[model samples]
Each structure stands twice: as C-alpha cells, then as structure tokens.
Target: MIKRITAGLLAGTLVLALAACTATVPISPTDSSGLGSETIHVGIAYDSAGRGDLSFNDAAGAGLDRAKKELLVQATEATTEAENDQARAETLRGLAQGGSNPVIAVGFLYATAVGTVGKEFPDTLFAIIDDDSVSADNVVSLLFSEEQGSYLVGVAAARATRTNRVGFVGGVDVALIHKFEAGYTAGVRSVNPGITVDVRYLSKPPDFSGFGAPDKGTAAARQLISNGADVIYAAAGGSGSGVFEAVAAAPAKVWAIGVDSDQYASAPEAVKPHILTSMLKRVDNGVFQEIQAFAKGDREGGSKRYDLKVDGVGYATSNTALNRYKDDMEKARYRILSGAVKVPSK
Candidate 1:
C-alpha cells in the first residue's frame, strides 16, 4: 500500500536562504515554429546532489536541458544543500515571483515546502517530483513507483550473488526510502527464501547527508561487504558512488546495483564493470513530459504517477552481469505488470 502523509507546512514561518545559482542554460531559438511564439520560463529547485551527482538531481537536470533544446524556453536552476527544507519555499517563491510560470521542486522532502508555497502562488503553477501530499490547486505531484523498480534490481542482486548473501544501502530512514528497502527485501526473498539480505542506512532523519556523502556510503558498503554480502544494491542517490568504490576496492569479485539512473552507463570505467544493474526511475521523462504539457498550455494541478505499467520505472540491463538474466527479468517484469506479483511499498 502507498503510504500517505497529510502534515501541512503552512503553520510555521520559514527563513529561506538565497538560492545559489549554479548553472543556467538558455537555448537560442532557431525556429519559430516550435511549440509557440511566447518563450516559457522554466525553473527548477534541485536537491542536494545538484547536477554532477550522476544520480537523482542529474536526472532532473537532463529533463530541463531537453526542454530547453526542443522547446522555446528560458530556464533557471537553483541548487540546495542537505537538510535545507526551509529554503525550498523561498526558492520556489523566488522562481514564481521572478516570472517562472511553472516552477519544479525535486525530491519528496519538498512536500511541506511545496504545500506551503504552492498555496501562496495560485496563479503560478508548481510541480514537485517524488511528492504527493501537497493538494493545492496549483501544485502538480510527480510520483514514481520506486518499489516496483527496486524489486527488479533485488532479483538481479539475488541472481548475481555467489555467496548467497546480498546487501541494501539506503540514503535515509524515511517512509519514502523505506519503500525501496521493503521491495528489495521482498524481491530477494522471492528469488530465494533461504538467501540472506543485509540492510543498512547511512543516516536517519534531520541528517540528510546520507544522500550526498560518498564517504558514508563507502563505509556502509564496506561494512556490508565485511558481513559477507557479495551483492550490494544502493538507493542512496549521489552516495551510491561510495558503494561502487567499495566494490572496486574489495579483493573478492562483488557486484553493485545503482538507483534513479543507470549507473552502468554513467559510472566511471573502473567501476562500470562492477555495476550489475540499476533501478531505473525515469525522473527525466517525468520532468520533460510535465514541461511539455505546460508548454502546450496544459497545466497539471493534480498528481501524476509513473509506474512499471506505464514505463516510468524499471531495471537497467546494460551491465554484463544482468544481461545473462534478461529472460528471467523480463518474465518477472511481465508477472508484475500482469498483476500476478504485487511489489510492496512499505
């Protein structure tokens, strides 16, 4: 079942820091026939990883970049640090007040901030990724079935493990991330009830560094490896690189799985060989589609969901380790799609 929270962030007054402008890519319009004559100003308030994390934030950035190239758009991006939820409201407010019609907020952590600010800006449409609690008329919630995809990678980890033991590394201990852990555990059990799955979280609430700190991820991965986990799947955003590093440094041949985007295609050459697969969450497609709808004068006010049935989430098969299990994975995917298998969210 999908866990829903109704806590509103409109009660407290938030002090927002100035949005640090990291990068801005404005495309020159070459053709007037694209989309429309008026230029759409798109604004994004990014998560802690920002653009270079090669993970969640980068996926969001890819969507914005695509919109700028294909449509007549002037885009602006703002970066956020770990545990800076207060600043999210100001960032969105600034974008709307500065003429950005539809501002996008990345990450589920922005539920409170988006709820609070979205109510204030009823005219300017707001879209938030990974959150669904905000019910304002101007807010668009873009949610993904992370558990469904996480389950697929769990199967990969189970099939690829030689020690009959695997591990899961989560960025934080929250309801949103727990879905990943729950599905992974369920998938591992489905593969082999006798197999052991070791789970660890980098940090708890109020300490969001678990998603951004590579060293912590490396430490968690090493610990899991020491516990005889030969296959480790990480859903820790940018911190996932640390899991890759740990796998690379291990004396024994171990496998690692990535999240959000396909790490096999984006990881460094040295670590690429160790990545078994990735839980592909199509945040890029979701963001790009939402922008396209807005550009076409279609404003989304309700929640937009992306799942396996709709190709919003899946497992990456670019890695050699997972390539051999292609048929089995496809069968499992079909089972999930056909309702024969129900992946747990919590």
Candidate 2:
C-alpha cells in the first residue's frame, strides 16, 4: 500500500512538470530594464477613429498600454485621419528627435508617411505597424498576416453558412485589406470550390478618406445581405459598426466578422449571435513587442512581418460559440502552423 501511494505521487509530479514545460512561452527579443525595457518614450499615430473603434487602432493602443504598464515605457499618441497619419507622425517624430525619444506609429496607412519621416529624423527610431510602405533602415516596420487569420475565419464561415454566399467588407483598397480579401476568398474556395464571395470596399483603392465612415459600411452591408450573403468579414474600421447593424436586422441567419480586436462584444446582441468569430491580427502584441525590441537593442531596420508563421495572426471565436467547433478549428490551425496545409496569401 505504501509503495502504491509513492508511485501515484511520483506520476502526478511528472505530469505537472510536463504541463509547465508545454505552457512555457518561447523567448523573443528582450529589453534592458528586464521586463521588456526600462523607460522608452513612444508616440502612437493611429487611424481616424482615435482609440475607441475596438479594431486596429484600439488593438495597437492596447499593446502600447501593456508597454507602459509592464515595461515602464512612457507613451503618447497622434490621433488623426488617414491623410493626417503622416502629419501626426511628423509631429510626434519632431518630439522624438528633440528629446531622444522613440516614435511609434500604428496602422498600415502610415506606410507612406513613416518612410519619409524616418529619412528626415534618422535618429528618432521610428517603429511602425504594417511596414513603411517601403524600405528604410532607420524604421522598424511591423506587418501582420491578416490573410492567415482571415483564412481560418473563411473556413469557419464556409462550413457554417447555409446560403453558400458570403461578403467581404473592407475599409480601403490598401494592401492590408487586400490581404484579408485574398485570404478569405481563397479559404472559401479551399473548402467549397463553388462558394460565391462578394467583395466590396468602403472607399476606392486610392482613397484613404473612408477608413472610419460607418454610414457607408452599413449601406454596404445591407447591399451584400440583399444579394443573399449571410456572413461578412468586415475589415472596415468604424464603418464596420454599420455593417453589424444591417446584419442584425436580417431575418435570415447573418454573420458579420470583426477584425483586429475582439469585436464579438462591440455590436448589438442580435448581430453577435450570428458572428462566427474574429480574425485577430494581434496588433497589441506587435506594438508592445516592438517597443520592447527598441528597449532590448534589437533595432535592426527593415520590415518585420508578424505573419501566421510566427503565430502573429489567428482566429478568435467566442469561447462558447467555438466550443462545438474546437476539434475542426484545432485541426485546421495545426495544419497551417506546421505548413502541412498552405493557406494562400494572394
């Protein structure tokens, strides 16, 4: 009896030790003050909605918040429209340059503006999300794989939809939106070769003006639903709210996917029931990680892609909503992560 008890106790200890090892986070770059960094000053320039859109800007801001709270970083932001992304970046860059502070810019929209800013303020240490739209050694560009996350959502949507038709509502025709659209369309095709994907943009490809217009987004959603689309993955910033409103009013089953942040809680109750899941780009992780990198002396220039390969992008279905689909989701996820299944990034 004593021998049996000893054996059980030893087995339990080994199981707990194995669990701890499996849960350990792989080490990435680190900073000076130990917890990612000491006191790194940062300036955030985001989309037009400022901080409450619960999407890209909010996700990035969350990261900045983490840096300030956990890494002892002092941070500020430049909240302005797409056209003003560069202007705001310049304003922040000036501050960073004068006092030896680092300026962090959010959003892919800042691509064009940040590259020039990096050139003018070579010492400012410009870290941007979604790349600088070009190459610059002074700037650390962070880009994510929206397609990878969107691909998972696409699979879920295809499997869940009874209509076999879905919608893609994009903020702008920029490369970022293209990443979501391309991956979503391909994912649907991968699952069901004949599924119909209706793609629509809130604004034209070159027009950055429509990044936060909700009215246009709602109108676009209604149109997509009218044509029999039951599920839509909306990448349109604030405009996505309008899309949610439209879907909520539908009699037939309608689902509108949220992006960047956990938008499951952002919309009306009726609309949320139909939401399949969210394609989280982990912007907050990117933001905080970049700030930490700067603190850790990993200021190597050029673009750093937060792609699916690095678990940078992923799907977020409600714990309850996806509970039933966990098996399917896990299988798909492992395959993509292992490269056993290729998710097209077209």
Going through the candidates in the order shown, the clash numbers are 0, 0
In Å, residue 18's CA in model 1 sits off its true spot by: 14
Relative to the true structure, candidate 1 reaches a TM of: 0.89
Q: Give residue 42's lDDT in candidate 1 (0 to 100).
A: 79
Model 2 superposed RMSD (Cα)? 14.1
Task: Pull out the clashing pairs in model 2.
Answer: none
How well does candidate 2 match the true structure in TM-score terms?
0.84
lDDT at 212 for candidate 1? 89
Instruction: Give RMSD to native, each candidate.
Output: 6.8, 14.1
Give lDDT tens digits, candidate 1, residues 1-346. 1111111321232222222222334434773333545667777888767778888988888888787776646676766553566666766666666677788998988878788888888888899998888887799899999999988878777788889999999999888899999888888888898889899999998888899889999999999999999999999999999999999999999999899988889989999999988998999999888988887677759998999988899988887667787776787788899999999999
TM values, all candidates: 0.89, 0.84
Predict model 1's lDDT versus the native: 0.82
Q: Put down candidate 2 lDDT per residue, 99-136, tens digits, no spaces.
A: 43466676666666676667777767777777656677
lDDT of each: 0.82, 0.72
Give candidate 1 misplaced runs (Cα > 4 Å). Answer: 1-34
Residue 138 alpha-carbon offset, candidate 1, angstroms: 0.3
Error of 1 at 90 (Å): 1.5
